[model samples]
Target: METPTRTPTAPPAFADVLVVGAGPAGSACAQLLARQGLRTVLVDQHDFPREKVCGDGLIPDSHAAFRRLGVYDEVAASAQPVQHVRCVGARGGHVDVPGTMSVLPRRQLDHILVRAAQQAGAELHTPLRFEAPLVEGERVVGARLQGPEGQPPVEVRASWVVLATGAVPQALTAAGLCDRRTPTGTAVRAYVRHAELAREITQLQVIWHGRLRGGYGWVFPGPDGVFNIGTGVIGSHSLEGGKGRRRGRNLREMFEDFCEVYPPAARLMREGEVLGPLKGAPLRCSLRGVSGEHWGRPGLLVAGDAAGTTYAFSGEGIGKAMESGMLAAEALLHARTQTPAQADAQVLQAYAAALRQLQPQFVLYERAGIVNDWPWLADLLIWRARKSPRILRRMAGVLDETQNPARLFTLSGVTKLLFE
Candidate 1:
């Protein structure tokens, strides 16, 4: 047999910053950096308008970021606006908590973000996969990238690098930035189209049941008659040092069970036409990949899902991903006014500190994940929330970020629910 051959690499290209992965995080980071006149280069393995396995739930947190990125109006134009979330418990208890929400397929959403980055003057490269990092002693000075088959690899030299690759990131491993390769959580979803079913489900539905002790299911309304339906569970990867090794005992079974148990899901399956095969994607929840100050190697910083920006309980990551990316951009902008050595030390340190500041919120969500194990609490919360407008308002607060989740997921909150 003929020996396999390695692709030859082209001459090195230089930039002020090299961003791998042009998802929301990478695109947001690149846009901010490029807007500030940093010669930013954004590369991705796939082209634009690509599908990203997601529920496409845009909450208030996401809206804030979209506004700051100057793409709020455009996103709003294409998204299906929602007014509330209907939480259904195992006992069939349901409560509709009013809040601002929207649904847009990730394929279109991510394309909008990439366009914003391009309009901001960031150079975009596609079919370009990150092969490895260029190391100089302790610092990562650049990276090795390869395009599609027959295309020569490209060497990219940059003053700094940002890793925004999503969950299941090989780039993290290549750059010596990965902590655990296993996914912290996993989800399966599909699009269903039925005129009647689509019209019936006007809001988001989050279902919890006894069989789904370690997970939850959701049905969100996308643009037109398409409805996004799915289930998710915390997977084998946990920060608990293997104590939380429940990375979905059986995801397919769980999904099938969800469809059977939840009436809405059953109706969708029976009455609606599924647009495509049920797709599954891995999730890096609870920021399991990075902790403390080890956010990145020298001269490099990690952002978005690669750095574990996805939350555990609610499974909302888009806003946090964009926030982390913007924070990385902020750190770089601030460091530009300092000495070379000081800038290097301060940039990574600053980015790490900023990420830590977000840790408390993420920690609360992680703690709240206990609801997946004890779904009775979900029943009680819905029961109480329906009767007590106070509890309902608090739920709204959680969505608006005006109130902490502790009000609903904590022991004290549970006790209050009983009394209230």
Candidate 2:
């Protein structure tokens, strides 16, 4: 089926900055740039209030971004506040940890931010497919886009281009700005409306169960009795072995088995209605050589998933994407007076340096065993936490991003596990 289309009043010339993708990264960058008096245009393939597959969990850091964009109140109004997180381990062991978190469907969240950006003077276009970048010499000047149906192609020329395209990184790859790498695995997710199930498991919970190597299941609760239940597995592991000798098992089958084991989840499956078809996509942790030299080529800059900012372990991308988009806009504003070459090399360099300083903390956590390396550690910790509440609390602090890794390792209870 052809994509839907919407047309706005056409401008005589191009915008100062053109952002491709209307996700958190694109909207955040467009709003900040427009707020600073730069003429910005934000375009997306799908319209606002459209659904996107995600875990629907938001970290504490996400609150800060919402506040900066002046949409915190709107988001809070639409989302469910989650003060506690319950983590279930293999063998039915569970640990209930308390912290500040929230969940909201992306349909509501994306619409809020895109609207905020438009209110801030950004020109918005929806259902626009980005065909390719307009290259002038080695520099990317703008992008070529086609609307739904036989509408003529429109070329948007901009002094600077910000790519907030998600995990696909299509813009970057198409422009020859960076090489695209395959993700380690795919995440499959589906939404369900389960009011009765919500009453039973009111707390936001992430259940890691089953024997699917390199994969785990999660049940994240959202507002208005909605929940997202999903599973993910490393592509390599899924290819290892299975009955019927199929190439690999799909996520739906794995999720079916998971629900069978959990009573609360089983009840939801029996009564809850699926919101839509199950969706899946590849997940990438980090990209090699993500600095400005790799990402900033002439008039273009990549941010968010396009820049490989997703955390390897938890698959968290929103907060980091917002941060990267803001930094890119800041760099563009700083380079407003310089020549294009100077702007690309110097101003963009500063943005890369800033990102490098901030990225280590994120990268370290991804490498930490909690997310990726050790399945046993999570199970063992959850099992132990059933007996020792102090240990569970400390670990919760780490997962909540309230405490540093150094402090986390120094905890006596955690240190005991390390030495033992």
Q: Which stretches of candidate 1 lie over 4 Å from their true place?
A: 1-12, 239-247
lDDT of 1 at 59: 91
- For model 2, name the residue pairs that clash: none
TM-scores for candidates 1 onward, in order: 0.94, 0.89
Which is the leading candidate under TM-score? 1
CA displacement after TM-score superposition, residue 54 of candidate 2 (Å): 0.8
**TM-score for model 1?**
0.94
Residue pairs with backbone overlap in model 1: 235-247, 236-247
Give the range of the ten consecutive residues with the poorest summed lDDT in model 1: 1-10
Tens digits of lDDT, candidate 2, 293-374: 5467778888877787766656667877888888888888888989777888876687778777776776565455243234
Model 2 reaches what TM-score against the true structure?
Answer: 0.89
